[model samples]
Target: MVLCTCFFVPPLQAQESPEVDIGGALRFNYNLSSWKPEQKTRGGDFGYDLFRINANAAYKGIYLNAEYRWYSDGFGGGMLKQGWFGYHFSKNKELQVGLTQVPFGIQQYNSNNWFFNLTYYVGLEDDHDMGIKYIYTGEKTEYQLAFFKNAEELRFGNDSEISHSRYSYDVAGRNKEINQFNGKFIYKFGGNVLQRIGFSAQYGSLYNLDTEESGNHYGLALHYEASYKDWNLKAEAMNIAHNPENAASTPDDTILMAAYGAAYEVAADFNIYTLTLSRNVPVNWGPVSALQFYNDFGYMQKQEDDFEDSYMNVTGVLLTAGNIYTYIDYAAGYNHSWLGGNYIDDFSRGTPNANWEARFNINIGYYF
Candidate 1:
């Protein structure tokens, strides 16, 4: 027994220590919007936008990743963007637990602009929740399955009211999202030009606090992506339905969604389609290494009668220089939230005669 114990102790002592890395970013923004007439008269506005910290650590097969961010007061003051612990069973299989990104149409992002797309406004893109995820990567295919308990909760207990200070939009106000299941599958075609086709599905229960009853929501999407040389293209289409068991006084055709310290009503049933194209060009300009020019467009068609549709288009260029990155974008929208129209009515009832509004924005960031 003593000889066997001695042999096991040496192997344990030889194990490597954990590797840790910490980094952060500081960013500032300048923008001029046609919607804000007063700001347009003042030659637009420039201000601090975000400060963030990222930490990652790995020990053998276990790892952790987290990010915390501080935004301007108009946005959420401070929030946890993501935090998760993961275990790698092998090089191609892993599991993540905690506040992780929801497995949806696209993996990281569906758009390549500062302002994402109409899909993001409708809570379909880049949405994260409190969940556990399992990922499998094969030679020509990938799979992801997840179960989210809820969105990130700001406080403890059974409080019915959810806070609006968050990074991801979720069902708020009288309804909360619960018991969500997500599944995504992707097939890759390898050649000179890499191509991928994927499908995603989601189903969740909407627990109404006011009525003490549960409703349901579901979404389905199909997406395709391709890259050839310096050119890339992405396209996706999806349909979503939200049925909330609200109080008798509330409308059934709309639901409340909250993020960035604000709440707004969104159409309950809608179909969204998006397309993006980009080209990377190598440059020899001073301190600027490369430039990527992209255009992203999204359209939303509401299902209710007399409801106006929403659409957005963003044309942007990203400049990368060592640790400094800059994005210059010209974005235009019609009856879209974050672009123009009334706060709570834009995505719900909308204005039939709404004119196109445009904004010019520049964002600079230093990452380390």
Candidate 2:
């Protein structure tokens, strides 16, 4: 998951004296994988993960939010996560321009685990792009409409080589994502037990430089979230399809997706279902104040016959202590990109009857 700082300003305080806040996080990760026998033999690997800087500023009715991150060389070295300028039209309406998060599926996250759900792998969750967005907030409803010109471009012009060293995954290489439109609506039910139901839809074009033609892609999702005291639940179902006009020699069953300095093949059409359940337990154990235990599960059903499906399940706990946060997770997957199968073959033309692989991980971060 793409982790970043978030700022919330009350709607009633739209116009404020010039204010600026800068903060960031430092994180480290350790993991042992079943797929890597060498690593298992040596126990595990622990190393620096990332350092990020976030800035937020507001003057009058205008605001700016930006984040930049630096990761280990193996991951994307350095890149902008998100930067946007927004204007408050009124107490409940705003418009944002520049690189912004795509309003889809769950709002901030669909899963509480550090690995996130499978939707994130396919760019259905926590994806960001260059776009203009309009947001409206009501007492019991919310709406977001956006139009993205294309995915984040490292260099101008279509002839330039696509860079995989970015934060959010998108169609890369010969096929480029362009002219995307998104609309999301949500209704909230307030009571002792809070609940929210939402719908999201997106349509975009895939411009193939080799074929010099544009194919289309679309997605629809239905999501629900509920909270009752310390218990929380989230569920979502989505269908995504990509029809790319590629060179005749290329296969149509898969598309190229790139992120974090790497590109991989993903199934062209699939349906994804995800569910997350969690409970918060409060405690006073020295500096540790609370812990949240969660289980996140996701399944991807491929549309093509004979193609293998993908499965991911994560059981984790989040520990909160002042400025420090930590996650301990046991994650397992079958036909998953980061789990077992070959590096680039897990999501596309996956191994049938693939055995499940597992990983144990710990991530700790300090936020200012």
Candidate lDDT values, in order: 0.89, 0.90
How do the residues 92-125 of candidate 1 rate in per-residue lDDT, one tens digit apiece? 7677899999999976899999898788887888
lDDT of 1: 0.89
- Pairs that collide, model 2: none
What clash count does candidate 1 reach?
0
After superposition, which runs of candidate 2 have C-alpha atoms over 4 Å from their true positions?
A: 1-17
The lDDT leader among the candidates is 2
Please identify model 1 stretches exceeding 4 Å from their true place: 1-15
- lDDT at 42 for candidate 2? 95
Q: What is the lDDT of residue 48 in candidate 1?
A: 97
Cα RMSD, each candidate: 5.3, 4.5
